[model samples]
Target: MKPHSLTDRPATLNSRYNRLALVSSPRHLALLNKEDADTLVVICDWLLWQSAVTDGWHCVHFETALIDNHAPDPLDMDIMLRANDWVWLDGVDHTLFHGVSLGRQFCSTAQYIVSAYYRMDLALRKLLSEFSCREVTLYDYWVDRYLVSPDLRHLIVATVARDMGVHFDDQLDPVLPGDPALAAAPSTLGAPPTGWHKLAKQCGLALHGYAMTVMVAVQRRLRPRVNRPLVIANWNMVRSFLQSDPADDCQPMVLAPTLPKTLNLLRRFWSANILPCPYPSVGLTQQEREQIAAMVKVYEAHWSEPAEGLEEAMRRFMRASVLTLDNLLPLARQVKSVQAFLRRYRPSRIVVDGVKSPPLSIFLELGKAQGIPADYIWHSPLAPQNIRFDNLGCESRQEALVERCLSWGKFNDMWLERIGAACSSVRVGNPVLAKYTAMKKSGGGRDVALLLQLVPAFSDVRGLYLSQYEFFVEGVRQLNQLGYKRVIFKMHPSMWREEYYEEIARRFELKVEIRKHGRFEDYVREADLVVGPMVSGAMLEVLASGTPMVAYFLKPSTLDSTYFDGLNVQSDISRLGEAVTNNEFLDPAVVLDLYCDSECGQSPAERFWQALSRSPL
Candidate 1:
């Protein structure tokens, strides 16, 4: 069955149910994103249209991924008002997380995933008791919070999975030890997909970051006041911010999600050597902690115990739930906390990172209200994506939100067109990558850098809308057949095994080596040609660094209209080997067009600082 589209849902609602909650169907969830304004408009438009025709029953929509902790876009707010909605609940961003049983205790992808929503469930019940909701109707699917029945026990209508013959399972199934067993290191290449669940196991040190999460939560807790600073959102922005010249005298105070994995990456800044200067944290404050603790207490009071083996795990899950969902009061407290932090620190400017958490939009909202200069950053490239730029996509909303933008060179014109010439845009090649790609020395060897993504979403719909991991066996097969002897497999940080390259070599019988340790510049310095999927920002940086590139996509239908006209790109999943062997993407002239809009003679870091420095204090 096709995923639910605007025209695909049932035309009318059943009058039997008065209070209805329109939870995002998988199809709708797949199409909508909290960060994209146009996506929000499209989704809200559909929900409002549903509300328009419905009878006496008042309806609310639950996106589950959005935490609209502050004022929304006027138009989006208007639509939601017309639709009369709930929201993408805070701490309940189920789209990116799941509950995993680690030993006797349980943990989630982030502290705010499936576990917390369960606690919020009881809170929701308590709140619902105040209303006259006899039997609430839900319009969602099994893909939402793993346990979503208690809140909407009336009816679950319009789930796409049900049409496809998948039954809803409510069991809080614990992840077994080595349950997603390692893919057989393939002796001779005769195997099928190892099933979806098995292929979706946590790669490496997923849970190990818990300690760091706590440590940072305590050590760099939010301060009442920070020294002269520039406020940035998410760890990715911090990564880019610190990559510039320290003498430039810019201190970055980052607002990051307090999650284990994120905390682990943030802790690495001490010795990163990439940072020319020090940065501060945006972790929870004492008040915020107290509020969170109280929320946990109230949430736990409701769902105190669980069945059998899930006792301790369920308790942790509840704690984790409040850590993620829309408990309103605590989130409002967090907003106050941010307000206090901003008032005290008074960052020279506020930057809203679009690629990071959606609530970070709060920063932009606050910036606009307080007369502080706030801007947005695309922070990456967009090609080989499901989004079609030449035809339609929702990125233009970002261009409208900010007065100025810091973007990749190749995409500047697109943003200008999307937002119009009124918005000033600087074609700053990704500063983080620019710092990494610095010191690139020309090499006289024939070696290739093949990037491997974790989940290839175009090829597999089960994964999130991200692509990076497809190459490896297929790419190596192609390159080796093309007589390229030396190849380096740069593993994404999310990969679990340290010896993953060795595993690849052993499994696929290739002459490829893994460059496990080194900065990106080190790898770039050693390679003659950079070959990877076009969907990555790093590849663009490689092109800007005067290196030739060949970008691979799964198929032509999945390819977006890339930036350049004569760019070296091939989209043939069936004959990837032929595409690589024939040098279908080999070009030096294409690199000229790539860096043209990506960067100027000035370093990206300098350019970014200049963009932020546009409106002076």
Candidate 2:
């Protein structure tokens, strides 16, 4: 049947019984014929359109079915109706399920329920409830049928609203009135004249500073006055935080920082206002700042730093108010959103972690310009003045530049002087390292393990393939050649669908095991050594266990950009054999003892909290 647009569907209320009857029998196919199939198509189309328009969801037509094979036996028509109502609930993508599952409770219950809706609703509700928020409003139109229902709509709406602690308002009003030129003319009539003039006025900045300073100022401002501040620690930092009493009220919010999308989603749902620390505009350059300021609200001339013509722009156009410790340099594309959040929340402080290079310095300068205090949580201690040669293989030009600039600018001394000059103090800590030490000693049994992470081959700029199946095949072959037996080949978690690893294992006639369940540490403990490209986390964990590590650098060129540079990056598989025979491994005592020492061993969490406590907003 040809696809039909839902906008043309006529509005009419059909009872659940009638709708179910129409869809339940094979004769319903004739109904499509009687109404030119367009009617049914229109109804379906309209329903999808309404849902999408109401909620920020995308829905697409799958296939027309005379009878749902997945429908329950003895066919409870009521349940079928409820299931149908729920098929598009919350605008969740439903392409995964082959067909809808119908049951008896759906029919007689009068509580029109969709299994998919309930599942998603429960999961989302539970996830939101864990966070401290006044309320969460899920605006979507796909559930219009349920919303219009007298019995089920009210109950579901009320239940969801109460659970989320917020009002659930479904605006059925069309985003754009009518259609085409007629609908758009009304909006244009009131639109501002001279777009270029408005654009010019929008892109202006007032102040600039070092990125690190902005981060510190922001962090200082965000220090919780009442309860303990939430410290976000990944699996690697959880144990360390739990062991140390950083402060009486400090709460740990354990989360992996790797998933940017998940973090963005979480940030959207959070209620707390987000404040972005301004940094010196000098690092951003005039053109870059102009581009940024055009989209965001630029706060001007608040602070002065050593950089030329540098300033900060406070963005106020974010969908969610999120106080991100992550750098805003890469997210220049979302400057409007960032500006939105800043404008709405006007957050007092911005907490910044991992500000080691120019980006960090730029953020700090920007925060200072914005008049927002910044607090920095440093993972590694300040590199000594003589340690310039230490970073011999860093591929990032910005990193190299920062090192050179700081050296020329005497930034290390200035930074230390600034640390003492500022109201707050610096913290020396490595939360991940601490967690690894504790987990290894805890005697956690082996379960799932990541054996190897294949590094992609790099060529010219913009030519790196993320997946290197061929390299992985070569690595596996090399491992077998070295008398290594019974090794479990674990592909990166992100590449589960790629079956290349599985196929290669089969072809090699190797008796290697592949794991798919349980804690990754279990595999780490069972295995003797971790062999892969520059996956620092695995190496760090294995080092904590005092297990041997053999890193196979894909190429010397590839290692240039990795953190492994100047830190024993191996180029050949032969190194693995040499390390095993030579009993070469990083000394846990030396590494751990460095952190254990009074100079660098201080708990970072404690130092961070103390700094926050001392900051004058």
Candidate 3:
């Protein structure tokens, strides 16, 4: 059979004609003068646009700037058109102008020509190798615009061309095309593929395809409405989980909530109940209550339940649902609630927030007896934060026991072994990091902000209270020593109680600004650096923003050494000076490795998702 020729092809044959033409915007073309030409060539292949160039086909490369009536006289249209059959190079607004110019230039010359658009620089680099051809032409213009790196641009081009089936002459580069799993592949991060595998086996649990579902369960709470970092992390986990499966039993769900406000947004995505176990006096307003009700309605649609008394409601939800318990209730109450709920729901897993809640003994007993997987959902930094309150009746024994369990060197290993056996821990990134990235790009300025969780240093609450004041004083002193002028301190939402701000000022003898409760990312974005001693998770948020952090570790009496060891805690005050100066210690990849590897387990979100997937209605 004879091969097909361009002349014999139908004027509008869809199979022969390229439906997608990807040209870079004017901004990208300007970058060509600055970037390595070889790199540009490589990018074209990576973008999958190399085939068309090598075939000596008519490919038009246009600059958006030139098409906007910005082309200079004495233009080298021939040099531009040397190899390609057609070329139109324009400046900014070229996308608009190119359409007009193309119509006038090719009006009646060709039988049929469909204009498929792309950016200018992308198109040039894609067709640069075929510059030996003579029929090429160019329209010129110039404009300043930011362009992605040639390497990244190449990958993008290749992906688009691959999807469009137009072979670009560029070699294909590995690109994470909006698939978190491909981005989070073990090879991508240079980590072991079986990292979660080891964790599951250690936990002595079966690998159920529940993690992806659980990710869908709490994706809202874990992510923001716009540009959520946790979404990326969740995507990566979901992709990994799906690929790990040999069968089609589990598929990932993308949770996008159509809510205006942050409060109700979570309900749109998750069926799991989020009991806002705030302090007693922290009452919800009428509007807030109505919003919560609306959210509940949406939540109940997929995971519905009958209304009952508080105890029974907790029991029923715990039994049937994947329980997410915030640590506020007493140890006995918390354990009993979980136990009762588990008996009814027989849930596949549980996530307990707040490190100070239930004792380790209770969790161990529950795990040993019921084979129910459990993990922590930390929301604060691991370092101390300055706060004061009178602990009138809180017990210390439970605190001590919990601290001991967290500190035990073998506890994490054992827990990992147990949990890792059946279900893998999903490594979800912090959502706050995503928020901070947006805030910074907008040029919102707040120099230094501290997120403080206040609690008194009295006998009952002494265990929970570390001397964050000392760390703050030291942090301020160091910042001053390093010649930083302005600093803002954001009090944790819980610290709004009493005169915590006044007390902090009195004790520290420094006029630190007390910021109002708001999105933590705003503070992170505005501030140059974040300082705290005990807010590990919050530090994770800061790290996500690629911000510098100065942490002061005030060793609590009952604190676990293993927890500190796992953290690779940098407690030296001098190190803070170095970190502030170098600004290289706060990379999330480094921090994640330190934290994730500390305990052979998946991320909290990952574990939660795993549980949600296995729980029967």
Candidate 4:
């Protein structure tokens, strides 16, 4: 199937192959046009969306760009809403995989799959709306495979087409050899683990599995002598609950499920007796494995053909799904183990940093089921964003995940009410805010801290033009030009690709210091001014600390920025220096009052611990 040439009439286009060839790279389209393919092209990437405008073939782009003349389609939101609703099968707010509620067992994995599906649906619908024919030709040269698996992609595309009452004549165009110039260019940021890297990962997982098995057995034997409250947290979170005490009595023992090595060091050096709660070493039962095998049929019914036959595609998808499930099995097992732990140990009350984490979420759910009270502390600031509100609303209602929210301040209360997270609230004060307030700013320092966030190229609410690498390199260049003597790059805890950061630094020849460890406030105190993206959670702390900070608003976010209206929110990178130097900031006391509105006499950490101790059963 081929696209009609410019001289060919519309009637000819309707005869055989409809007008579209989906290409992975802009260079691919250039090559196709050079070869006189004369087909209408469709682009899938955000960065490539810009090229479609200038490129010759009247291309249709999936990603909406800043330069797009038309207003965003209202149907885009409708599509998202429909996708969200469809994920919950049979009117149940749960994603089922072979009759098992994957959403209930593994929240993050289900959310990821649903999110990917939604994005794919949006792209397909956007393309179809432009070319509203019942039948269309889609020349598949889309080989940029980093974002999603080919199997899952095929399944999503087929399902969306079926849902929209459309049929596709997929023509498999062989992948063209990449242009050397384009090949070297940074298009996609990350690569999937392969070769020796893959082997090392497998070996590490096996070791962790063995370690978890031993830890679970040891935990059973080392159960607390007397029933007391349990603090489900990491070593750092334990500090918020307990003061520096001489006695390591293991009362309200901390369950640090993440970072066993760190826990070992903390146990040896710290006052608190932090227990390692590794993920349980468990496999699916025979019945469950059979159920997983049945799940392949669902995918088989929906998957579109690639180079392989339908049977081969189904076999590959089945194997992939099973492998994925095997990786996630520990989470399911951990959930069960948590229930058992609650039954046997019978903790009086359970306190968690947040209910979003699997270990903490499981404890929250089980605590409620077993008639035990659970307290939720606001570990980090929750920005009042549209995406977050929808997500919280959906997840909270799906399960009564929250029993009592130990809110940081009035700000948290407002967010809770808005999202309808209908749980009792106690203003326990924010330890993070309290810690920041205690530190005196060492003003007169020449150091500037550039706080980094993990902003991906594609997301449900993403509107950023810059990739993570582009943003960092450009930010450093701007800072370097601004006569900053020493610039410190502070990576977000969640953005743990140190090697990636190092590579970016090396490629750009950036003169900066990288700090991945220690307190965010320590860096804040050391710097004269702090600069970071507006979406960063660290911005809240900077505001609370009354530090001179510039919130870089590169793009529009789903988050309401009315709160930072008076503060420094610079959209233009060129004016960042001006904003930083002038430093006309909001009054620190005002920010503190609004965000950290707690009883002022006691420190937030002390107030938190006291609140936990006196809470009624």
Candidate 5:
């Protein structure tokens, strides 16, 4: 089946696919160099008519000179691609061109939006809502336009962020005074010894992915980037979670990153060379710094609820930062720094585990333009109709989006169908799962593990589990009553620091092992039974491990009806104690059918080679 060209498309196309191809042609990058700006007229016209977003856009041409003073906006790029009233200048603007006066003329027939004023200049944004409706904001386009095309990629624009860019909206902690989790970060500024040569060497390693003189895309000082050299660009904890601890020098291997440890040892396997990614500190303009500082107040209102507010607030912040041009100065500088870092690395292929982050969305798009292949390895199963909310109120019943999506379970039927709808996904099993193996049988242990989700800071509220704080706390109490000696409460990484875990464990007198990091596989493997939230990706890992597991849905929604309606999943936590002690929950075999077929019974390298063979690379 041919993709819809610039002219003709179905009135209704799959939104997920629309998300993949924000711009009609990947060749848009090639046209960027053309001397004539008129070439963009065609592109803009095509975007005005053919783009995926239906809300329509108010297109305005920004001066190219802004690139020097302004930042590269991944979000604004989405707006230009999606709007019907799309505007672009015939030539680059040497002077500022406020789109407000132009918006009134073009939007007479259009709906009202609040954020549109932020679209042009931050100074000009206060003049918004003088015209236009309230149902919309300035723009809400996505930043993953070029993320779908691997063949179009020549570079991999990615990052390895340690902090994960999280900050609380409030100055003071309401629950815990100076929450141990809020410990002051050690100053990293100018912390390294002022040695020019070492800094230069670090620069070379980061910029070129190899030694200074090396021109190849995959040359690292520690290892060579050969046969799909894997460059790990972590937006979250993926790097630490997936990468082998340097202390684990039990086996000598090239690059010494863990993926090749077991599977590659079985055969002369083609594993990627792990590049050393250093955390970079780029300077921010004073204006950019101030704008970012003000975000705390703005976000505090957007996310006022407790039980999972911080995560939702963080998510809201990212979406606003990445999806709207409301404030692009900081984001722009960040992108420039990211691009410079990635270009220095010159990576051939990129590997991502778990879901994509909003902050990284721009990098992935940039990678596609450079022709780098990114392998998105999700932690859990991708439901055909995965729930996505408008705001952070994922638990709020009113927050449900009524838009149509592709029918559920269609992707599982065909091999090519998976991730082919938009982004290219590989079923390499869950990286978190790969770390686990059966620890004998459940009979030897009377322990149970309750894997927690985001709450008290922000609610992920997947399926039936809404209040992760209340649900998991009660879950532990119930499991404890069931005569389980150890109800190991796996702490969420966002919630748990090493010190915080010890404090919570001691303070609550909670007789459970509070793990701060990726020891989930170890605990799940050791536990007699594993119970998780209503809809967690970790379910596949538990099910595949041959562990007796149950999905505890508090509200008993569609997921329970589809996978475990009749099965022994405990929809009622009241019955959890009776069911678990009596061995009445789901058997591993019944849940195995949901596993990504190629991922089952395979190592990451084994499954990766199979995926690469089938990939265009």
Candidate 6:
């Protein structure tokens, strides 16, 4: 049956059993038929609207159903890997960013829209299967409104319904008083900066790029034949260098698009060869703009339902791909600028966090062209098998960009080998771990630091809201029962939802301290025990700090099975207090040996430098 929109006929709540009504926007409850059902399945942060709905309605929350750990979900990854057709146009390969087929980037950007469509489809199917319901009535404005772009909302909702064979109701009628104008399409491609703000940013970037280029020229003249390794530094690299005391010989010139405050500190103390590679607002040539427009047309018109299902949705997804091509013009500009910089100065080597990123890979490719070998430092903890490393289908194609990978330790090296990463792996250890190893451990106490992972609501990270809810509400309740008098709630560095944490704290009536700032190491040293409910590299860092750590999760993850294999990983929130009490933490030395490979004589920074020196191009 075809989907139906609202009419003058008012929809009334039905009390029939086995009937389910999934509500994305519940404001117009008067218009909802409730599927002539006994249940109301509220998707995405249902807790906020739970009290408003009818009592005794069986509700399944969106977050609770899908467990997200910030890492790529298996389903999401499968969706990404399933498509090879979207990038092909006519006979030639349209799957390229600059001169390379950046298949991973293209798929990932397409997924920003398509994944949401498929996920909603999955959610509906799952709900029907669990409830044993024949038909599901959808009251959704969430897709229509909350999506990053406006044009894709109706398309996604309609596509999802048809794909699932569910009776789709477009929207509830008798609009809520203050609801946003549904017809208004805000610029799908984000609004560029206007007036003085735009001008200032452009001028700043241009000046910074020129200044860095001049500095490199002067440095080349002053110290001929010096081994100047150019570092395409991100925050992680800057933080690593900041923590470690690098030798004079190991200093690499830093090149970043934007300089965080920490980089300024690094420049003052460490090396002054820091420059901003002007990426944003790069002046694109007319030819490049025309090329992007042409590519957009091809991608927009192209549609192939890969054998992976979601056939009807792929068409809209292809159209959505047009929006992401905005990056193409900027990428071309970046590549041109980088080529000039690399050719002029001729850095001895290129150092970056990873070779997988499209932007970072540009540096690697350019460096390779100029005979400058690239070295990628293992920045984060190696995630476990299946969900992360396995089934990517693209890493094998991209790994050749880097000449060598400076790994964290044996586990990373082994995993890299297992995954068939083309680069040779060297266990140079991590500077952050080395520093953590020397830190004075906190004295035994009941105080616990709970690391929170709070992803933005309705984002690609599925079930993230549920993860936060369980981490805060359920986790705090469990801690209180255990008689843990003082609990410090450490917000994820990327988030600052103190108001949400405070609200949860007030509800629990527990003595909780919400910490929005402070390094991960600082939290480990201050608390007697570190408990991270979400998957994080900091958990590995906690292991190196000699502090007892409990990896808590609502469901078993790759991290639980692999990294913290023998350690205390509690999936049962109720048993968390017991696990904390038992405190059978992993031995720091063994953990260090496996993950960090710490050296007694030399620092990790020094070790990495030595490894780089040993590995000749």
What's the count of clashing pairs in each model shown? 18, 66, 81, 0, 29, 0
RMSD of each: 16.6, 25.2, 28.5, 8.7, 21.2, 7.3
Best by lDDT: 6
Q: Which stretches of candidate 2 lie over 4 Å from their true place?
A: 1-348, 353-369, 375-427, 441-450, 456-471, 474-485, 495-497, 515-519, 558-569, 589-599, 615-617
Per-residue C-alpha lDDT of model 5 across residues 1-617, encoded as one tens digit per residue: 11123223334322221011112232332323323222221121112222322322221212111112233332222221112122222322111111111111211112112122222222111111211111111111111111111211100101001122211111110112232332211223344645897898667445543331242223344354334333343322243233332211111122222232233322222133223343244666677556545444443444356322222322333344332344444455555555665566555554443222323333444555576655444434444223222111222221211111211122333322421233333444433444443343544356565545422111111121123333544566677777787777776554234453344345445566666567666666677777775355566566656676657654412121354455565655556677666777565554544444422454443444344342322
What's the best-to-worst order under TM-score?
6, 4, 1, 5, 2, 3
Give the per-residue lDDT of model 4 (tens digit) for 107-206.
3333344444444455566656655635434443232212435555555556556667777656434333233312122233467689999999778766
- Tens-digit per-residue lDDT, 436-482, candidate 3: 44343322223554534322222111121223333445555566566
Residue 544, candidate 1: Cα error in Å is 3.7
lDDT of 2 by residue, 277-379 (tens): 2322223345654544432222122122221110011011110111121223334423333343345334444444433222233333344445655544434
lDDT tens digits, residue span 433-510, model 1: 545345555543455655444334322212221112224556666666666667777754442333534644564467
Reference-based lDDT, residue 312, model 1 = 33
Q: Which stretches of candidate 3 lie over 4 Å from their true place?
A: 1-267, 270-446, 449-466, 480-485, 495-511, 555-579, 582-587, 597-617
Model 4, CA-based lDDT: 0.52
- Per-residue lDDT of 197 in model 6: 91
Q: Is candidate 4 or candidate 6 better by lDDT?
A: 6
> Which one is best on TM-score?
6
- Please give, for residues 1-617, the per-residue lDDT of candidate 6 as tens digits: 11111111113323233545555454645454444356555444333333333343344454333443345455533334444344545545564545655444445455545556545555555555555554555554343213433334444455555665656665532223233423112333457999999999788766656665565556556666556677675666565665544444434566645465333553553353333333333466787677767766665556433323454445555555443556566566767777766765567778877544556767776777667888878676544432222112233333366777788777777666655556777667777665676775754676565545533222233433344455566556666666666677887643234565575566546567888777776777777766664345676677777777776544423222555566455666546667767875556667667777764445666666666453431
- The alpha-carbon lDDT assigned to residue 286 of candidate 1 equals 67
Show model 5 residue runs off by greater than 4 Å. 1-330, 341-351, 354-359, 371-375, 380-385, 388-420, 423-428, 438-444, 447-466, 496-518, 556-567, 598-604, 613-617
Sort all candidates by lDDT, best to worst. Answer: 6, 4, 1, 5, 2, 3
lDDT of each prediction vs. the true structure? Answer: 0.41, 0.34, 0.33, 0.52, 0.36, 0.54
